[model samples]
Target chain A: MPAQSSPPRTDSRPGGRSARVRAAVHQAVKELLTDEAGDALTIPVIAARAGVHATTVYRRWGSVGELLADVATSRFSGDVVVPDTGSLREDLERYAYDLAKDLSDPDTLALVRAIVGTGGEGAGVCRMERQRQLEAIIEREQGRGNQVPTIERAIEALLAPLYYRAVFTDQALSPEWARTLVSHLLPR
Target chain B: MPAQSSPPRTDSRPGGRSARVRAAVHQAVKELLTDEAGDALTIPVIAARAGVHATTVYRRWGSVGELLADVATSRFSGDVVVPDTGSLREDLERYAYDLAKDLSDPDTLALVRAIVGTGGEGAGVCRMERQRQLEAIIEREQGRGNQVPTIERAIEALLAPLYYRAVFTDQALSPEWARTLVSHLLPR
Candidate 1:
């Protein structure tokens, strides 16, 4: 018989076994995305890579699309910070610049491709979460008395272009391109 | 076997055997996208649908991605027209509106996702063709002495956002949204 830790605590705290499991799964996903672009990512494969039980992984994320979205949500937050440059235009411009810079990475682009092209109910959930994050940042700017477009409008104008160049086209994602988005939106 | 026409003519005019073959293949791709959103489309399956020889299909379009891109290029031109209404703002607004309208269709969206997520090599060619078509329209506008943003900037600001909304989110595409894009760029 194999010695195993006590059954996973159902009521674990923030840094408990549950969180560790999530971190391990996320790490495995990051590694897989890095090691193999355009590879089919199954939960079983991810569990094997993470040294976690397949049942546990399956219990949390039922489909590759769900897992992919979770990975993107985690990575997107860590990579992009909401710009807080006092003025709304400057804040947006700076944020857009950073976003473009981060999204330029091949790994990030691949992650985005997964989210954007992963068509299903899981992708729907992912889009909702992602859109909320984007709106929260925009709302914060509006709260600071900076006039901004609607959240949907801002996403379409500011964020979409960066992603377009990143995944859809073979174009460079320069900071200048981000600035161009800001200039178009907030014509100084 | 049923009677077959002579070997496909290498040098056929616009409405000749070559044109007919291309049309059939494009039509088959369209039907497949509509009927089966996530079906793996092989050269043989597509050939059977188009009633064209598998070798002929393979010779012209080496891969599914290539065939899909051709379908998109053909459809993109027909569905979207360069807005030639007098004023540049009006032109862009109308063009953006039409783009959003056309992109909202399920079939068109599927074709776009196919190209965008087709990974390396294939996506590059599709993007290049799409960008060229966009440039041609913008160039025509610039030729008319409209002080528009560069072709690249127009794409970033105007085009990318539409695709982002269409494919990346569950938001509805509206003509009003297109007006917002135009206002953001060419303010009255």
Candidate 2:
């Protein structure tokens, strides 16, 4: 996730500053989701945090789903930078471990769920970004003349466990789980 | 998923019958989820369909999350019947194709989202039931002197893609995709 940018308020005349309001609202969403320690992402709660009137939020983004779609589009246009370990398996292990930690964060989980719930451009962007990153990894491995799992197998091994445990079960998404997934994929 | 049961209406006296009220509400939830083509799952909508008072629904379930937890618990206490085959790989392939068809249902998608959104006992139940079924399959395979993917790997291969696609993308869960996952697991 990216850090929130603070915009100048001097250009913030109430009647004509849609950009300022948008920034404030987006910033508040980022901040609140970063913590995940707040109340539900109700419009009133978000509007209060943004220091904007609730009506403004309602008018600009009619529903929480629309707002989440915008957030996902703005924030997750590409995959997170992948670690370049010497080997594909090591790289996958490191990526899975990092993802495990990210999935453990309440805010991260909520952000993902909201993105998925929107089922809009945000989710599409997320899927495409992941595919691009996976392709890059596979290309590098093929260049090395190494056997590699197909992208679909890699997806099942690397991404699915973290998400399935996070979304469907109360079990902790642990580094051990990450290790187990990589081991299953490579089976060395 | 279990088939819907039609309980006798004589037990529904509108007073002093918590069991009857619970059954009605559960039945209504099942019916509505089966036809996610209808409308959103809301207290008033469910209550009207169940022939129970809206206040009763609200008082019992409190929210969609709570209601969904109960529905999942009631509906998915056991795994759906798996097709039998002499070869473990063949069995898995058939099961994955069948599951692909089931997951393609709009109602199944909604039910899964609701269960995940609830993130309560229902999810726990879903996980455990699948584990039991997978274990049964593995025992049969071991008896035949055949190797099997661990339950964890099996889950990542067979179940996770259905969910990952349903929750995270607009892609159809095609039979081809199902075959790919099974082939990746037990490549010939």
Candidate 3:
């Protein structure tokens, strides 16, 4: 991991006392969302949790939806790393296995679930961000001159079963499951 | 689609007005959760919508978490159809392409986003029902007696790209996307 003097700020807006307060509020909100699970989260409650004034929350974000989206962006940070392992099959298998592990993690799962559930303005934003991540990964792999669509399809095919199992089915996330998905799904 | 029928009753106890009310309440609750996005729902609002007393909602579901899970089971009516296409690749590709189409529909996407956004309770129920569907498809393919995990993996591989694109990325659900995913992912 790159040594960070502070958490990387992707937003280009000026960083000041307000930015610091917003960051703190977002961290508090994320923690509460993870811990409380379905409990009604109010602005006052978040303000108390973050040790900030209620006005700070209102002035910076205006609504819980905006705050949640900011938190979602921070929590589900990083791009999908695309790998080049010579063959499309190897590359896809690795991508699937890695993504399965990431999606299965409780923290990532919660944030993803929240984004999926809260499908208002935030949901659309999260969906678009996720798309950007995929496009970035595709560009990286395509730079290597592997057939873009084929490689992209191969990677998606390999990862989809584990996700289907993890998110929509009851299958255990076993090495066998990953390997089977790869072996059967990957072009020989 | 199966012949339409009245919603099922939830009471077996004799001489029960409360039971009838409860049954009506749950049925209405189920529709609200499944038929719409999460943003449009609230317990008080649901009670008004169902024409049930608000106290009943608290007594039966206790929390949104429990209510959400119940809604998922009630909404999921049945499984996917897996046609025997004479070859594993054909069968897998057919299933993949069809499932992709099913998933891409607006109602299904809304349900998926809602179920995923909530928590593990709804997620678990949703996954179990889906597994039953997928397993039925797999078992039929296996019953042809040429079945292997590799075949299953390949089928999953074939379908994963469409879903990954739909769920994790913002790609348009084009016929070309479907063909690209299936052609590269499906085993010969």
Best by DockQ: 1
Q: lDDT tens string, model 3, A1-188? A: 97878876665457766677877897777777688656555677789989999888988777666777787676555665665666655665666566667767767666666655654456555445444544555666677786565445444645456555665554567765676566654335
Q: Please list the C-alpha lDDT of all candidates, in the order they appear.
A: 0.71, 0.72, 0.62
List model 2 lDDT by residue over B93-148, tens digit each. Answer: 77778677766777666677555543445566655665676667777898889777
Provide the lDDT at B175 for model 1: 89
Interface RMSD of 1: 3.0
* Candidate 3 segments whose C-alpha is farther than 4 A from its true place: A1-15, A41-48, A51-59, A62-65, A78-98, A120-155, A162-166, A169-188, B1-45, B79-98, B148-155, B158-166, B169-188
User: lDDT tens string, model 1, A1-188?
Assistant: 87677885666566688788999998887787666343445677789989999999878887666777778667755444566666777777777877777777777776666555455444454345445656777788778786777876777677788777777777787887678777766666
Q: What order do you get sorting by DockQ, best first?
A: 1, 3, 2
Looking at model 3 chain A, report the run of 10 residues with the lowest lDDT sum: A150-159
Comparing 2 and 3 on TM-score, the stronger one: 2
Model 2 regions lying over 4 Å from their true place: A1-9, A12-20, A23-55, A73-79, A118-121, A143-148, B1-52, B77-79, B143-146
* Ten contiguous residues minimizing lDDT sum, candidate 3 chain B: B146-155
DockQ per model, Cα: 0.38, 0.34, 0.37
